[model samples]
Target: MAVSDQIVRWRYRLVPDHLLGEILTKRWVDNAIPVLILIVVAAVFGWLIPDFFSAAGISSLMRQWGEFTLIALALMIVMVAGGIDLSVGSTFALGNIVALTLITVAGWPVPAVIGATLACGALVGLVNGVLVGYLRLRAFLTTLVTLIIVRAIVDMMLLKYSVAIAAGFVDSDLWYYFGEGDVLGVPFSVATALVLALVAHLVLSRSRVGWHVLAVGGSRRSAHNVGIPVRRVICLTYVVSGTLAALSGVLFASRLGGAGADTGVGLEIAALTAAVLGGNSLGGGRGSAAKAIIGAIIVMIMVNGLVRIGVTRGGSSLLLGMVLLAAVAIDVRWLKNRHKFLSKVYVSPTYSELPEAPATSGSSPYALNDRLRPVEAIGLGQIDGPEDVILDEDDHIYVGNRTGDIVRFFAPDYTRQEVFVHVGGRPLGMAFAKDGALLVCIGGMGLYSIGRDRSIRKLTDETNRSWLSVIDDSRLRLADDLDIAPDGRVFFSEATVRYEMHEWPVDCLESRGNGRIICYDPNTGTTRTVIKNLLFPNGICMMHDGQSFLFAETWACRVSRYWFDGPKKGTVEVVIGDLPGYPDNINRASDGTYWLALVGVRTPSLDLALKMPGFRRRMARRIAPDEWLYPNINTGCVVRFDETGRIIETLWDFGGENHPMITSMREHKGHLYIGGILNNRVGRLKLDGMDPTWSGIDSYWRRT
Candidate 1:
């Protein structure tokens, strides 16, 4: 290899360029910005303020954070339900006054006062729910009106009860505990808030109620169409917000023991800023308890720190306004452009150098011929994308198609067909178990089987994951093909780990070694990867020797044999290298040979372009997807080869009348059946000088 070639090899091969795209695709990545900001904000404030990290200062900060967290959480809940609660500040003031009046004037018990406070908040929420949800009033205007009405009522109550609240006092242990207690170095309010946050997180993330809330937030009309009670869900979200806000007021009232006229004024704006600054979406349908809590902590720290550092209240509010504006702008742009960014970095192209194509021009072994063009078409226009074909013991033809159905045709005439079973995922490669069970590889699913009784069963959906893999490889992404070993162990190929079944073309364009061969042992019901870093590994066929198997690497355009039981066990060797086209399914021929499907022929232009990864990357970015260069899948052919890796002969569909893309073939009763991934029909060609009694079923399952 040239020095330049070696440099390119190490650059693409060693550097894992796919990691960033993989990380960006995860849902948790959305929290990254808020967490980073939280760290930086804390650092900046701690440095700016004297003794900000002192034991007493930290405890005071936690107390404030705990109360503010509840109010922010209340706002987040309403936002996630596609509504906004502007009256939370007023409702919080109501709870504060209600608690002070009960404790000071009415001499009520602590528990009873708490219940009464919560009830008042719930009553206010019911009014909001009835108007905004049931009456179809806009949330913004309705909540704003309610905010004014609730604040007016709180002002009246405070004016009437303030003198008595300051004059009378009750010394209660429970009230003091709630106000200033500590639990193992954590503040009383902090401990309480953390527990509630955990419960709220579970209810929102891990329960059906949470799903409904998110659904309502995402789309009210769609949620209603899907049988979700849109009005009820929205109403319930407001009630939850009111109840949580009241509870926060309960803590605050206990801490301060009284309220003034200006209590809770402008509190709603601060809570809204905290909620949005934590990365909760303002457009609704996206938020979390963690985000609410993080936002509250940052706000509480910044505000309290600013006050202690001699910054005026107005200056602190100004800074908060700026932060909220910036946060809202970021959330909108990130939502709109995340996928656009992904499209650029996600399809990372790596260096690939396909070997020189063999001479397929006139008089060569692979010279073009219209052998398959005259073949009889089976189930034409009646089937969809039959990717693999097989014969049962009775010579009944079966083929797996893209529609996720296995269609069967009666042998005498191939005109009629019926769906044998629906697999829910596109069925690709297939083989038989010892007892005649049809083992199938389901794309985007995993290995499954159909018994003689027509029962479907999942064999395995996952394998052991690689420790160093950045992305989860345990779950099968696309199981392309499979074959059963003599010991009943099933060997299968996963075409590409990075791309799903629909993105197979993209995977091919990258030409990375994202494919792997996995084996599932029936005896232990365990699956594991046997070969890693294959280039689009497809068809799997247990070699006639019963000790090895022939597997095709579609993009690599080669056939390779893996030994499982012989002396060369745990090793692989190339059987046919440098084919003129991409190989698909490999099956056994009647006379001790192997039949391989060349799904797409190689082109000189494409072969040359594959070696230059930089040019391909530019093409993918600059051109529309349909205009991009793709593998030349225009020619369909099949070649017969021996164990010694010599191509015996080739059959070509020069005109591609029936099999436009030959993906698989089977031989039985002296007739060859062909299947294609892009063709709507299967083809059958009568072979002369062949054994009529020869069948794939007997070839593998018959007694010696």
Candidate 2:
């Protein structure tokens, strides 16, 4: 190998250039900016305030953070439901006063005080729900009206009872314990908040109620069209919001021992700031419990930290207002242009070098002829995208269909067919196990099997994960082809971990070594990656000796041998390097030769583009996907080669008369069964001078 080619090879293999784009694609990347902002704010405050991260400081922050978190979560729920709760601050004051009066003055038990306070919140929520949900009143105006009415009522009551409330005190030990208690060094309010946050997260993310809330929030009209009960969902959201906000008030009252005029003033505004700043979407449909918690910490710390530093209340409020404006600005722009930014940066390309194309002339051994022109089409216009075909012991014709089924055409006539099994993923290459089980490669899923009873079993869905990989490569994304060795272990080709089966063309555009070979041993029920940094490894065929295997790297236009036993064990050697077309599945020919499927023919344009990584990168970012240049996969031929990697014969259908883009070919009973991923039917071509009685099943297992 040349110095430049070898350097490029190891550079990409050792250090994955694809990590940056992949990291950006992850769900948590949405919180990147907010997390950074939180870090910067905390650092600045920690520096300004002495012992800001000390035990006492953290304990103090937790008490206030926990209380504020519940209020933020409450507002987040309403905001997620496409509504706002301006009355939350007023309702909170009412709950605080109601709880305090009942406990200290009326001498009510703790449980009764809690119940009455919750009821007060529920009543307020009911009014909002009915007006906004059922009456179709504008949420902002309705909630603002509720805020004023509720605040006015609280003020009138406070004027009459403020002096008496401050003089009263609860003598109950449980009340004091809950108010100022710590469980295992963590404050009771913080512990309770954590528990409630967990429950809310599960409900919003995992339950039907949560899905309904998001659906309604996304679009009320669309949600109602889909029978999602938009009005009911809206009502449920407000009730949850009010109850949680009131619950926070109970905790606040417990700690403070009384309520005042400024008990919950400007709280709704603070909660709203926390919601959007925590990465929760203001447009609804996109929020999480974690986001609420994050927002709460930022808002609570900023306020408390300011007070601790002796910053005046007005100056602190102004700073908070500025922060809220910045948060809203981020929320608006980030939501609008996220995908646009991803489009430009996410389709990252890496440098790759390809060997010069060779030997496709008529005078060369790869000369194309019209052998497939007279090929008899089987199951014409019946099946869909049969990527690979195989014949069982009974000569039953099995072809993998794109509709997640293995369609089998009965033997002899090949007229009758049925869905042998529905695995519910795009099935590709297939092989029969020793126990008559049908092993299949399910694209985007993993390797699966169908036993004699037609029961489906998952062989493996994941391998040992690669360390430092941003994307989880352990989970199988595209299991393209497979073949069983002499041992119970199954070897398979993962075409590309970067792109899915449907996005196979994109993998070609990058043309990077994003593929690998995997081995699954049923004996120990263990799966692991055996080879890495391959260019779209597509085909696997266990050699006749069972000591090694033959695999194809599709984009590299090459075939390679992997030895699992003997002197060459644990090593790979290239068998053919200069094929003019992209090679796919390889199967044994009756006369001790191999049949290789050239799924696509190489063009000079694409071969040039492969070397010009910069050009391909810009093309991907600038051009529409359909307009982007792709290798010619529309037409290709089948090549027959000997054991020593020497070409024997070539089969062609120049105009694709019967089958185009041959992905796999199985030679059985002197006839070759041709399958194409883009073609609708399987083609059967008779061979003049081949073994008529030879069977694919008897080839490898019978010798053992």
Q: Whole-model Cα lDDT per candidate?
A: 0.88, 0.87
Q: Output candidate 2 Cα RMSD.
A: 2.5
Q: Model 2 clash pairs?
A: none
For candidate 1, give the lDDT of residue 202.
97
Task: Note the clash tally of each candidate.
Answer: 0, 0
RMSD (CA, Å), each prediction: 1.8, 2.5
Highest TM-score model number: 1
- Give me the runs in candidate 2 sitting further than 4 Å from their true place: 1-17, 54-56, 206-208, 215-229
The residue ranges of model 1 lying beyond 4 angstroms of the native Cα positions read: none
- Lowest summed lDDT across 10 adjacent residues in model 2 is found at 8-17
Best by lDDT: 1
